[model samples]
Structures are given as C-alpha cells and as structure tokens.
Target: MDVPADDDPFEAQRERASNPMRRLFDEYGRERSGTFAVGVAASVFARVLDLLPPLMLGIAVDAIFLNESEFSLPLVPDRWLPTDPETQFWLVVGIVLFSFLGGAVLHWFRNWGWNRFAQYVQHAIRTDTYDAMQRLNMTFFADKQTGEMMSVLSNDVNRLERFLNDGLNSAFRLGVMVVGIAALLFWMNWQLAIVALLPVPLIALFTYQFVKTIQPKYADVRSTVGQVNSRLENNLGGIQVIKTSNTESYEADRVEEVSGDYFDANWGAIETRIKFFPGLRVLAGLGFALTFTIGGLWVFRGEGPWLFTGTLRPGEFVTFILYSQRFIWPMAQFGQIINMYQRAYASAARVFGLMDEDAGIEERPDAAELVVDDGRVDYDDVTFGYGDETILDGVSFTAEGGDTVALVGPTGAGKSTALKLLLRMYDVDDGAIRVDGQDVRDVTLASLRDTIGYVSQETFLFYGTVRENITYGAFEASDEDVVAAAKAAEAHEFVTNLPDGYDTMVGERGVKLSGGQRQRLAIARAMLRDPDILILDEATSDVDTETEMLIQRSLDRLTADRTTFVIAHRLSTVKDADQIVVLDDGEVVERGSHEDLLATDGLYASLWSVQAGEIDDLPAEFVERATDRGARAETDGATTDQ
Candidate 1:
C-alpha cells in the first residue's frame, strides 16, 4: 500500500497566486471571445441607457416644471430642440420610453452572453483538469484521494463558473454606472462632485482590507471542502467494510470531524464577508449623507455650501443627489464583487496547481511503437525500490518465447514488483528489462502495454453489464468470441446462471460478483485481449481448488505457444512450470525445474518439504528458518491486505 500524505488545512493556500484570474483569462478568454465581447458590449449599452432617465428627469425638472433653466440638452444642438414647452415635454417622454425599452433588450443580451461564456468555460476547465489529472503517474495518484481530485473538477470548477457569470457581469455593469454617473455629476457641477466623491478613498481602503482579511479564510474553506469530500467518499465506498467491522460510530465521528472543519472555515469567511459588505454600505452611505447635507444647503440658499461659490439650481442639486446615490450603490457592490473574486481566485489556484503538477514518467518524443517477435522477455540485473528501501536487488531472469517461467516467493518478496517493471508501472533503478532485445522504455507505452496481458490477485471491473466488462479493452470482440473466452476461463457456467446472464449489471468495482467470479471474468477479459505475452501474479489465489484446476487446464493450453510468467503462493500450482525461480528477500536464491530445485535441498527444498507435510524431515537450522519465514510471510500478507 502507498503511504498517505498528511492532510494540510492550508494546502490550497500554498497555491495562492498574485493573479490567477489573469491566468484564467489568458487560457480560456480567447476561446470564448465571441461571447465575452458581446457580453461586455451589452453591459456597456444597458448601464449607459440606465443613466438616461435620470439625466432626462433633471432636465425636465428645470426646463419644463420650474422654467429656472433653459431647455438645453448635453449633446443636442440648441436649434434641434423645440422652441415651445409642450414639444419639449413630449420629447422627454419619448426619450424615457426608449431608454427603458432599449435597456431591457440589452439586459437580455447581457445575460445570454455571460451565461454561455460561463458554462462553456466551466465545461472546458473541468475536462482539461481531468485530462491533466488522469495522465499523471501512479506514484502521483498514490498520495492523492479520488475525492480531492474530484473537488477540483466539481467544486472549484463550478466556483469559477459563478465568478464568470455573476462576478464578471456585475463588475462590468458597476464599472459603467460608476464612470457614467461620476462624469455626469462632474459635468453638472464639478464642485459638488468633489464633495460627493469624498468617501472614494475610504471605500477603496476598506475594500482592500476586506480582501486581505478574507483571502486566507476562503482558501481554508476550499481546503476543508476537499477534506470533507474525501471523508465522505472514503466512507461511502467502504460502507460494507464499516458495517462488517461494526464501526458505524467510528466512521460517523470521522465524517463529523471533517464536516465540522468545513463549517468553521466557511463561517470564518462568511463572518468576514458579512462585515465587509455592510461596512462598505456604511462607507458609501457616508458619501450619500454628505452629498445630501451639502447639496440641500446649496439648493435652499441658492449658493454652494462651505466656501464654494456657484449658483446652485434646484434641478442641478436633484441631478447630483441621484448621481451620487448611484455611485454609492456601485461602491457598495464592489465588496460583493471582490468577495466572489477572492473565492474564485483560490479555486483557480487549485485548478491550475493540479494542471501544473509534474508526472513521474515521460515518453520520449522519438519513442517507437513496439512490435512483438516471439515475446522473448529479459531482466538483466534489475533493481528497484520505493522511497529508500530496496525491494528488489540485482534480480535477473528470462522467459524465452514459448516458455512458462514461474516466480515463487513469500509475501513482499518483490514478485509482483518485478512483474510490474515489465508493464513499466515503475521503472528500474539499476538495470534493464527488454522484450525481444528491445528495451521496454524505448517504445511507446501504449503499444508496449497492448502487447502484454496481465491478471493479478486483485481484480477490478467497471460498473456495467457483464458483457460490457468482459469486452472492456477489446471493444470489437464478437459475441461468439466473448462466449468462447468465458468458456475457456471456466466462467461460462457461473455467468449463464447469473440473473440476466451476461447482461446482468455489475455494481461499482464489481461488488455484485463473488471473488472467484470476478477473478474468472478478469481471466476472460485477458483471453479476449489475447496478448502475445502474459503475466499471472497470483491469478488463482482467490478461487476454489476445483475452479483453479479448471482454470489451470485453460491456462496450460493458452500459454502453449506464448511467453508466460507466473507468480503463485501455492507452490503446487507451478510444479509443471518449465523454470521456477525462487525469490527470498528480493534475490533469486534458487533457479531450476521443480525436480532440480528439490534435489539441491536449499530454501526452495525447505519450503517444498514444509508444504508437503514433511516437517520432521528438515534439519533444525532449516526448521527455525522456515518457521521464521512463515511467520514473516503471514505478517507481510496481512500488511499487504490492509
């Protein structure tokens, strides 16, 4: 089993970037430029149109109602306006109607464009992240949980979508309103505009503080989310085990602990966020209150307040109040926008961090496809390990074409590890493994693996109908061929008896099937694969003696003309093997046919004698050694199983 990494509550925080949003824009912005451009245009149009009614209202108040100001508009030529008051009233009504109608239409376009951009970008991010994650080596995956990776694809990716949809849209809309209102306010009266915008720096400072305070909290929330998901996934997957072990309360405690962590983290961010938004409104309200007090005095006295000298018309004061309030709302909303942006930033960092994670192995650009010629496999002085402990040392062996070579050893003897090297699950540390005189690493991984068939003690089946699982890798296998393969593996009887026969659904990981049944199905799948070379690592370890005999008969026939390697715990299973190489503590101690090894009477003979119920025939030194080895084997077996 692989060692698990310690849980880091600040794991996502470590990936914090200065500008992950910029990275997101760079990667996917070009792809969705069409929708993004349209969305931006619509936001500009709608927000600008929203300012029209206020502008027209101010003009109508002065020119039409009180006649305190001339009938003048900002951009229109004076000659274009009507000379009489009645025509000016009609013109204001028409402009207001157009503003409302045009704004509604643009709003629809805004929602459509932003929604499409968000959904498409979210889908692309998830797919790309999953692609990057799945291609990483087993070593990388060993320290990761499935639920943690899924959090990136699901929670983090969906968070980015929300930011793109609501956060980005709000940002554009508020930006237009703030700019448009400020410009209009300044144009109407620059002195009052200065007084109204007094709280701008304070708002900016408060927002910066809010962002700084909540950034780490959001990261903690994201990290805890992954932790909670991992716990749930692990518990749900092993529910059967938990029930069998009567650990319901134990599992519940674990769930509660992780969930509690998430709650605390999320609430911390929520607390900060709640305080920030209302605090911004108060700061914004300061500007609104200041504008009201000063503008009211200016309009009442017909003079600017507090040393300012200007004729303050009632309509201009009214326009300033309206524009200043709009500015306040946008300033307040900047808090909400920043909130979403921080959340999305943490998620983006995680998504990009996973994408940037390094892989353990890489294929050369010039790697060639492997073509089998007799499948002559060789291991010359091969050595490998995990971490610092050596699992295999100076191991050398060969299985020439059409030969049946058996690797027999106790548990943790590196038998399975040795076979994995052929598959390149882990590369050798010292020497070379070649097939047909070509180094396994020199060829493209796909072609090399495609030519080798492997069946191990632990069998895995995807959730699907029996037929689908059997034909998994060999998608083109005919019904006749599938039935033939099942029959050959002695699985046809059990399969036909299952409910719905070959069409029966196997639950996740094939939990619906028995151990022997799953093992047999695995054999049938390998038979359908029909590789030129085969590696069987304890393939029959789970089956009954009767089933093993039946499978052995089929295997005997299947390997007649193909190169084969077998690793078996039950030495009797490999008695007929052409060559039996005995491994003890990673070194090959005995090598010969069954009879030849027995005559030498070494570790192999001691093991054979003990298994054959001839314990008294062994010497004292060999007896103590055999007993110790047996104890070690059992201990190792239990460890491996766990």
Candidate 2:
C-alpha cells in the first residue's frame, strides 16, 4: 500500500502488486479452466507424438538398412514385430506418417483452445477492470489521466493476450518436447546424453539473470507508455488552446520529450533481451556441436572413446544427434518464454494495481432505497474537506418541501460543494445531510441520485444526436417527451434549425454546438429526469442576456413544485428566492430574503450592488471582499504554476 516517491517510479511500481500474474489467474482463469486444460492437453499430446518420427527413423536405419540391430520399438512386445524385414520397413513408414497427421490435428486444437482462453480472459478482464474504474469515486479520477487508464485497458491487456497465447503455448510445447526427447536420448546412450544436457545448467543460469535484469526495465517501459499516452491525450483535448496561443512548437517539444523517454526505456529492455536470446542459441549450438563430435568419434573407432566408452551404431548415433538437437532447441526457446513472461508480469502488475484501487463509495449492507415524500432537505452542521482544506464546514440550512432556496457566495465560498453533499458526492467529515428524515449515506446511491436532478455551470454532452443527449439518462423517453423537454429548456428552436435536427451529430464533447446551445440541452436533460430535488449550479451563467431570460423563465416553471437549490454568482437569478443563504470562506455569512439582506447591507447586498451596476455606490465592505478574493486567486495561481 506504500507509494514510492516521485523520484522512484519503476522499482517500486513493479513491486506494487507482488505475484500479480498468479493473482490474475486466481481471479479470472478459474472460469476458463476448461479451455486452458484443453490447450495444455493438446500441446502435450502433440509434442509427444512429434518425437516418434525421429525414434522410428533411427530404428529403420539400423534394423532394415544396416541390419546391425534388431527391429524393435521400446514399448511394443517383440512378438508383435514382423519377422519380414520389408514388413517392418513399411510399419516404420506408417508410424511416421501417423505421427505427422496426428500431431497436425493436435496442433490445430491447441491453437483453438489457446485462442479461446486468451480471448475470454482478455474480454472479461477489460470489462471488469473498466467497471471497477468507473464506479470508483471522482477523487480517484481527479488524480488519474484518461490516457493512463486507456493504456491499461488497451496496451497492457493486449500484452497479456500475447503472453498467454504465444508464451504459454511455447512453454507447454517446449516443456514436453524437452522431457520426451531427453528420455529417449539417455535411453540410447547415457554418456553422450550427459554432454547434450551439460549446457542446460548454463542456460538456466543465464535465463535467471535475464529475468532479473529485464523485469524492472519492462516495468519502466510500461510506465513510459502511459506517460506518452497521457501527454498525447492532454494535448489533443486542448488543441484549441494550443492553436489560439500558437504554442504548437512548445507542445511538440513536450511530446518529443516523453516519446524519447519511452524510446529509451524500450531500447534498454530490447538491449537486454536481444543479448540474452543469442546467448541461449550459442549455448544450444555448443551442446549440439559437443554431442556430434563425441558421438562421431565413438562411431569411427567402433569402441569406447576416452571418458565416453560405448559401442555406438551408425543409426543409434544418428538418433542421439537428432534427439539432442530437439532437446537443446527447447532450451534455447526458454529465453523467449522468460522474456514474454517478464513483460506480462509487468503489465499484470499495473492492471491488478488498478483493480485493487479502493472503491470509495460503498453502500452499507443494510442500505435501503430512498423514498422522497416531501423532498425536504436538511444540511445539519455538515462538514467536509479534502485533506487539510475544508470546502464546507459547519454549514447548516433547511429547505422545506416546495421551496426554492438560492446559495449566493464568493468564488471559494463552498456554494457548489454544499449542494453536491446533498447528492452524496462525498461523505461528510462530520454531521449529516438528510432528505425527508433519511440520512443520504443510509440510502442506496442509485435510488438517492435518482431523486435529484443537476444542471452544472460546466455542461457535458457526449458525442451523439441532440435527442440522444437529451434522453441520456432517460433512455426510454418517447419522442413526444423528448420534444417537450427540449421545449421546456428553450433548446427546441436552435435544435430544429440544425441540419439534422434531433439526429445531428454533436461531435466530441458537443464541440460542434455553441456553449449556450450545450447548456440549454443540459437543462433539457435535467428536466426529463423529473426528480424531487433539483440543483442548478450557475445554470444561466453562460447564455446571452436574451437567452438567460428565456432559460430563466423555463427554470421558474422547473422549480415551481420541486425543492430547488440554486448556486449562482449572478444575483438577479436568485432575487425572488424563498430564502437566500449567503456564504463566505466555507461558512454561512447571512440568511434572509433578498430585500431583507439588502436592508442588512452585508456581503449579499454588496455583491448585488456591484452586479447591479451600482459601482459608484459600492460599500467599503465590498472593496475589502474584492481585495480578499483577489489575494486568494493569486495564491491559487502560484500553486498551479508550481
């Protein structure tokens, strides 16, 4: 659970989830066990059958061609063997052909089984990982980049598929080949078999070194991929700003820097890997060369040779050479297997780490569906903070059913944060927010959120038709209802004027539409929700004066019978509220009707005076408030720059 310092990125990142590959199998592989078993079984069967051809060829060479040894197979009974040499020859040919045909069939099954297993696991992991990610609290995403998560879902997952398909397949096939071939080699002649296997221990030592050295390098490479992706996504999303500011060269330089980091990290891993694979081939070639030289001398002398003393037949010597090559080939391929495994393990570590992120919004086991009777909302001494900075503290207010209460405040007065708590966006550090005497935390999140509608200052619209964005949450809304909601938000006129009307493509983030058009659509979507409580956070702040009046009229109808909490900087929007709560620095500064607050000559009255074009009549207290806000802005700007 410990996070490393920024200076230590990969060494600790690789260790974030220890034995992640094992955990991955335990979590996702059990369900695909049947396919996995099939792949492994087919690979074992195919490799075993493949070894039979070389053994049969050796037998035919000696018994039929040279006639130096009798015709026999190790497992077959001697009586089953034909006395006719020509018949034995045909039998060898038949067995070799069957081995090829049978091995071919098994290899086909192996490929199918592995593909199914890898694809199934890939699909399930991606969907499940994404589900977990989306359900995590907003604070998790606030600290994460969209591209980093995309890398996990795309690049990291595809690496796992390759490892599972290629790595696991080669591992199983080579394993069986090495074991079956080694057993046959020693059976023919133990002394020459020893020379063939001498390189195995060296191969194993080199493989271990390769894995140890390449693991962190691969981890570094994976991290750099995420950074590069993050940089690209950030730049592309803000391409407008870059173009307007003419910062193309600056942004390109930043991209090149991150891309260079990726190249460096990848080349480091490639350097280690390329060196290891060739070293393995060398060891394999060494073992094959040693086996051929020793076996040839023994065959030439027709007697024992030095430390290796044995009677080696031309045919048996040929078989030993063939089996030794097979044995060493698998040993050589072990390098590739280890290389793939290290990459997969690094990717798996990142994936499992993401899955293991704590889901901050958890429903209590005994939580029940929320039922709104009167839509009465109460903020009773509610307090919340992020770390040491309290956004809202000891803020208490009440809006009885059918009340429209406006929250007016300075920029950092916690106006929006206070309303968000009513939706249970974050749990209160202390005290509670209740609706109809039910604690927001004690109700199911879905049911609680279903009873509330929100229209934020910053509107979000997915790339879709005008109708699709309206019915986003209300997916089953009829055509009539969609039109009525759009009419209610004053969006019908602009939408109908568009080329495609209801079917128009909004483009990414609704970029094709103007800000006013997007905000009106957001209001329409909220109207379709038809919740017991409504939140309007600067809903009319972005529209023109004419559009604002039109939307304001619609909002009056929208908030008529519902309990509405409006956060607005424009004092005109809330001049007719049932009650106006003015806040300053995370605390309530005033609460009253607009006319009554103006009579008090406090912060609300001052903010109203400035917005009302009463600049010459600004009170001394208003000037002080402006000075404090300016100071806060500067401090925040400095922190952002750092």
Worst lDDT run of 10 residues, candidate 2, spans: 1-10
Q: lDDT, candidate 2, residue 468?
A: 97
lDDT of every model, 2 decimals: 0.86, 0.88
In candidate 2 the C-alpha lDDT for residue 20 amounts to 88
Write model 1 residue lDDT over 162-237, tens digit each, in one string: 9999999999999999999999988988888998899999999999999999988887788788888888999998
- What TM-score does candidate 2 get on C-alpha atoms? 0.95
Q: What would you estimate as the lDDT of candidate 1?
A: 0.86
How far residue 310's Cα lies from its native spot in candidate 2, in Å, is 1.7
Over 1-642, each residue of candidate 2 has an lDDT whose tens digit, in order, gives: 111234223334445677889987898889999999999999999998899988998899999999999888999999989989999989999999999999999999999999999999899989988998888886677667888889999998899999999999999999999988888888998888898999999999999999999977887788788889989999999999999999999999999998988898889889998999999999999999988988999999998688877599989988888899889988999899988998998888877777777788789999999999999999999888878998787999899999999999778788877887787767889989999999999999999999999988788999889999999999999999999999998899999999999999999999999888898899899899898999999988877998888889779878989999998888888999999999888898899999999999988888887888888878777788779878978877632100
- Report the Cα lDDT for residue 584, model 1: 78
